[model samples]
Target: MEYFQHEWLERNLNWFEGVSKLIPSTNNALESFNRVIKDENTLRERLPLSRVVVVLINTWSLQYTANAKTVHAVPTLNLGLWTKAYQWATEKKKKIVSHVNSEGYVYFIPAGQSNEVTDLEETLNASFSTFEEFKTVAFSIWTTTIPNDSNKWIEGTCNCPGFFKKLICKHVVGIAIRLKYANPPAEAKSVPIGAKRRRGRPSKARQALLVQ
Candidate 1:
């Protein structure tokens, strides 16, 4: 038992946490493909060699052909991450509330909305407000950054869709902004998420044709 425990400790989660930041060690594309094979083809039971060949060619071959043209890309660019982080820092930084767990290795930062017209502006033009860290059930899901870092924003992880897709997000970056760990570059204008810069000129308003 002691030997097993020693082996497990040597290969503990901290070893893989760093790996996850680089590349998901256990939850990679190949692992997902293997899971599909086990679940759909074998059903956790050993199949005959002939059946295995049938599953691979008939099922996976078509899937590979279909996705051959598919291009995998990170939606959030590095600049975009910083830009959105700056926006979040401007708008939602006031809402950031943190609580340190007993371990203190990681902390929570949650935000919420306000219906008040003044609060909706979300600018630091207002006076600075003090934030306290403690245990409380004050906020709900989606409003919180799922950052699992002690100090480094570069290593922080967020549960946001943006983060899930890109492994980085405004929430985590906003936390970094609050912590003063890193500053967004000067070119990172505080543009809201989903706002796109239109190419060329806007079309002139057209009058409806009158029945003649």
Candidate 2:
């Protein structure tokens, strides 16, 4: 309780708040793209600025062209980017439903209303911890208003570390699943079939040989 009150609660309490505008809450797409860059020699090794620019331009061009094609083929659910989030939310649904069956009740409150103290046991059982130093702080599932819109409650929030850091948590996922089915995001624009690909960087070995 002390660990939660002092450290975990304070830092992650509002992580899940105000996520209505987001589809998955997590930036997995961006992370995956970064991982691809890291896996390639582009970012792992120190290269000349010119080479770096070439590598980035090439990569971005390929991705942009591929994304354009994908969007054209399928125009729903952010071009299937939300697939993982949907799966995650589905799994959490089972757990939450089971928990509700056993526990009898799980409190659901509006996003900003969590400040009002209440019975802690009534909250969702979404607390988790990787370190022994801190006590696990259970998250309370709450409904959040969509960003730039006050009349809609399409967003959800939780007080979990996952939600705080990556903007994803079981509680938030559960809400997302329902919201996504009810209303999907707008379709992405497709790339032209004959889009031009970026040119590759000059070979350093060839440049060195030419100089010699």
Candidate 3:
């Protein structure tokens, strides 16, 4: 146990402790974006650099225009873990209400010491304004570990025993929820309205209509 704590856990898991909530903990979003790019007809096979550039530019331009139209709207959270984490936080809110009221934060009890309840870490706490304060609660739990190089929680160290066994815990969910609300990625650049059209020959359908 000591070896695991000092040699492996301490060395790897703590790297992004503080900043993990500020950015995505997984590369799923980037992977989805790459998938979209590859799905495009222009990118499905090997192509010349010039053709790839044209396709990329056209795709990006269209995306920029679409994003600009909805830039002010609230974005939805679609990550599966985030939804589960928010639900867990909700279920546990009543159990932690008194601590939150007295200490001004939620306490993280170690898995082995779940029943003792008194020796709480002063610095490690979760904060939320209301039962619906999902992001705040999640941030508090996610940033509990000391910052180190691994920047992830692969095992359980909290009162949530599932974590140590390398399962998802509510605390992790909370962090994911917080990240979903707090540090959304930047929107694509907006294209100007009324931009000049790209020059191209009329389409075959249009040519047929003209001939008719």
Candidate 4:
């Protein structure tokens, strides 16, 4: 990190004057940005990907200096995971069962591929005006699964047709937004243990096969 700072200093000799005015002469501005990035990811360990570093760079650059309300970069979590899943599923000749949980976790179930397992800790969360209202919104979003029927098994499995195409599907994003205000479980539960459940394949099997 220090090496990078020194390298940055060397490269910015010409821009030094303007850079100083924009940030500071302390040169610790990058460190502060890095700290913010760490907090955003909730990571306690070293980053596993150079892409993560790029994300941090972009996110901090925007938040600290760009003065933009929201950075329109790739989603730091879902999009990365989704791309990986799509790649794996394609390579191994498999499919993924994706759905939004009541708690707003986007569950990704790989059919015949992907060495990765479903992470109980999902990136999604819910939102609302108040905590109680948030919980209500969470419940509503979870309950609003497609087919417009009270089919728990069908919904849990994400068998609905319009799910994948709608990037920020109403039911899914709604629950996720609600989760922002809801209290989290004090003790994390282990992987859900119950009867094995399957909710059939996508109608877009051809589309799934073409994903590369």
Question: Pick by lDDT: which candidate is best?
Answer: 1
Computed on alpha carbons, the lDDT of every model, listed in order, comes to: 0.54, 0.43, 0.42, 0.37
In TM-score terms, candidate 1 sits at: 0.39
Q: Which stretches of candidate 3 lie over 4 Å from their true place?
A: 1-19, 41-43, 68-94, 97-116, 122-212
Candidate 1: stretches off by over 4 Å: 1-77, 92-94, 102-140, 143-151, 190-212
Please, what are the lDDT tens digits per residue for candidate 3 over residues 26-132?
67767977787778645568788898789977877787888842342222333333334455444433233123332123344333323333324542454434444
The stretch of ten residues in a row with the least summed lDDT in candidate 2 is: 184-193
Tens-digit lDDT string for candidate 2 (72-107): 221133333243344434432222321232322233
Cα deviation of 73, candidate 1, in Å: 17
Scored against the true structure, residue 159 in model 1 reaches a CA lDDT of: 46
Q: Which of the two, 2 or 3, has more TM-score?
A: 3
Worst 10 contiguous positions by lDDT, candidate 4: 182-191
Stretches off by above 4 angstroms in model 2 are 1-35, 41-44, 66-154, 175-212
Full-model lDDT, candidate 1: 0.54
Model 2: how far is 6 from its true place, Å?
14
Highest TM-score model number: 1
Q: Give per-model TM-scores.
A: 0.39, 0.33, 0.38, 0.17
The residue-by-residue lDDT of candidate 4 on 1-212, one tens digit each, is 44544565465455533222212334474796577667775354576688787876777667667676455332222432233323322343323334554533353433222433343234125323445664343322212232222322123223222243322232332233233321222221111222222333313333455666
Error of 4 at 78 (Å): 38
The TM-score ranking, best first, is 1, 3, 2, 4
